[model samples]
Target: MNCKQLQKIENYHEGKLQTEELNFVKKHLESCDECRRYLDELKSQALLLSRIKNFKPTLINPVAFRNEVLDQIQSKRNRYLVVRASRFVNSIIFILTQPITRYSFITAAIVIFGVFIFQQTIIVRKIESLEKRMGSNIVAKESGRPGRKNVDAFFKGRMEVQSDSDEAFRELLGNYRSLQIRYTVLLKMLKEKYPATYQEILKELEEAELLPENINI
Candidate 1:
């Protein structure tokens, strides 16, 4: 077992584990020699610690001690609050102004891309709906059913719909291909220039169990 798992054993043996969890830990300790040893070491430590006598405070001057602590606490609070407030003010200013400057350009780019994607999706949906409607109408007219439109008009509409569907597909393919290229370049630059930060990201991913156990880096 790892250190964290061993720590949990002490928590479990001390009756701190919840009901369902206690049962699982009990069952695990029965079969896991590593965990059993860890629990034994913790038990030994607790036994040794319990035999030691506690020291009583001899200062007796409660007011002086309290005043000193209060002074130190106030100094720390002032430092912490000033730093925190400065950061908070800076972040607020950036939020209010950066969008109109740096982020306006990014927003415009995203909007342009989003408009293309939205158009593609709408066109695709419309094409599907139109195809179904036209197919049903064709079948009805062919099977001796009434309420059929002019054949010339129907053919012209079908051609226009087919052309639009093909154009939408082409546009979507081009847009996604460009997005992938841009993302790949950005990721490559980030990984190369900020390798330590990238490794930290990878470590977080490993802790989340996203990385495989055999992964080297």
Candidate 2:
């Protein structure tokens, strides 16, 4: 028998060969001494291996094992995603915390503040300029305007008129009791139209010892 035909010693011993192949190995083993010994060694080895027990634990919970494997895979995937997110956040923080970036933000804020102050100052200056122009124009118009001699004459006569009014007021105050007695209807109308003012006038008259007891108001 050839090497290929002799190699079927294990198959023949294990009953793995077809009927034709089984007959081929069987006849070859009986005829060839080397292939017969090889077949015998294979049988001895099989018997020894079958007799020995496996020391490792047997897999009884396939479903639990599959879940545990999936859990580990998911946990690793989550860890990878977390690591990627952490790296992205760290990159952003690092960029923002950089001296140039921090200073740029500060400079931008200062420039905006300066622009606002400048705009406010310009507005104030414009308002002040308008006020100054208005004052100057008012002064120039007043300087060019002519004075009224009649108004000056009225002012000059006002002191004399004020003295005469003071004398008249004193006389009227002296006759206030008689005036109240004579104009009883007018006093009631004044009280009705201006209650607070009438009360104040009555209070003043009392303070001056001019109000009479017969004057009800």
Candidate 3:
């Protein structure tokens, strides 16, 4: 309430007040609810700061550590779920340092490697079996086809082409389609930038039946 009382309160906050001054302020605060509230607020704030200053971090659940160690020991452990390791930096190292943990990790790794090698061996055997089956089937199919004619001068040293006209036409059509696409692209560019060249190539393609006569660009 008074200037002297307020000065004493400030001195109390600063902690530089004499014993006599402290005793006087304590007496004044007993009769004054406002100063008492003010001191309580200050004490609460100081208590909070003191708690912060002397804070002791809590440990993670021991069950979680045990579960994490078990996860690492298992061969089929999830690589993404590293929940406990992130909390404690040396958890993995601590787990690995123990003789049991070391043996478990090595055993798990060996089991994983063995399974991988077993899978690879199975795959290699399957591939070899497939290759053998394919080779036998190919030989059987090849032997079923017509045999080659005489190599003598019976037909003026000319033997018939093994591939028929239909096969030849299909092959020719496939090659022509690729050539047609390239020529089409070139014709488009020529049509815009060089009209005479475009007309010549277009005429050649149409006459060769590579493109339809009435086809739109």
Candidate 4:
């Protein structure tokens, strides 16, 4: 019959309490006069509230209220699905394109490599031919030198021939070195002048072994 028990008056009148709770409040109200009077007043107020008319126009429509709530929920769900589907499609496209992209890159690399090898082959062959021709020309010149051969002159001619061969070797070696240097310099220049040509020539030099393998920069 305490004031705390009176708090259940609303729930009891509305029939919202569990059976045991309702019985407890009812029993307390029966035993306590103050609690019984308080419960009566609460009942009277609830009955008056139920009979009161407070409805107004232009403020609420139940159909529109339900539709607005449903539309908002439906819109959120549709947007979520669209975002998820877009991400899925983008991922699938990327996966499908990965192998094709890799294969195209590999094909380009192979083509460039082949062209470089062919050019280097041509350059090396031309240089070797030039070296042989130059050697023959040098030998011919020495053989034509005025020597009337006596015992002393014969030995001297032999010495001259050796010297000529030595000169040919030196000259040819020097020309080879010079050509390699010039090729390097031209490659650098071409990189600034024509990048495409420089790339092709660089590939040739690599395959031809025209320069030391470690000679970068």
Residue-level lDDT of model 1, residues 58-177, one tens digit each, is 788989999999999999999999999999999988876875766777888899999989976875555445434543443343333323343223333432223234444334334454
Q: Residues 1-217, candidate 2, lDDT per residue (tens digit)?
A: 4566555777777788999988877787777888877777888888888777545667899899999999999999999999999999999999998999999999999999999999768755553443334323322333332234322332233212222344444455345454444334434644775577457645654554434455564
- State the C-alpha lDDT per candidate: 0.58, 0.60, 0.57, 0.61
- Over the stretch 67-146, how does candidate 4's per-residue lDDT look in tens digits? 99999999999999999999999998897589887798789899999999887777655544433343344333445443
Report the candidate with higher lDDT, 3 versus 4.
4
**Residues forming the 10-long window of minimal summed lDDT in candidate 1:** 155-164
Q: What are the clashing pairs of model 3?
A: none
Q: Write the per-residue lDDT of candidate 3 for residues 1-217, one digit (tens) a residue.
A: 4445766676798798889988989888889887877777888898999999899887679889889888777734444346455647677677878999989989999999999999768755553443334323322233333222221211122423233343453354354454434434545655775587567655654443444333357
Candidate 2: Cα lDDT at 9: 79
Q: Output the better candidate (2/3) by lDDT.
A: 2
Q: How many Å off is the CA of 100 in candidate 1?
A: 7.8
Q: TM-score of every model?
A: 0.27, 0.32, 0.28, 0.26
lDDT of 4: 0.61
Top-lDDT structure, candidate number:
4
On a 0 to 1 TM-score scale, where does candidate 4 land against the true structure? 0.26
**Candidate 4 C-alpha error for residue 198, in Å:** 20
Worst 10 residues of 2 by lDDT: 154-163
Cα deviation in Å at residue 203, candidate 4?
27
Off by over 4 Å in 2: 1-31, 39-59, 114-217
Show the colliding residue pairs in model 4: none
Q: Which candidate is the best by TM-score?
A: 2
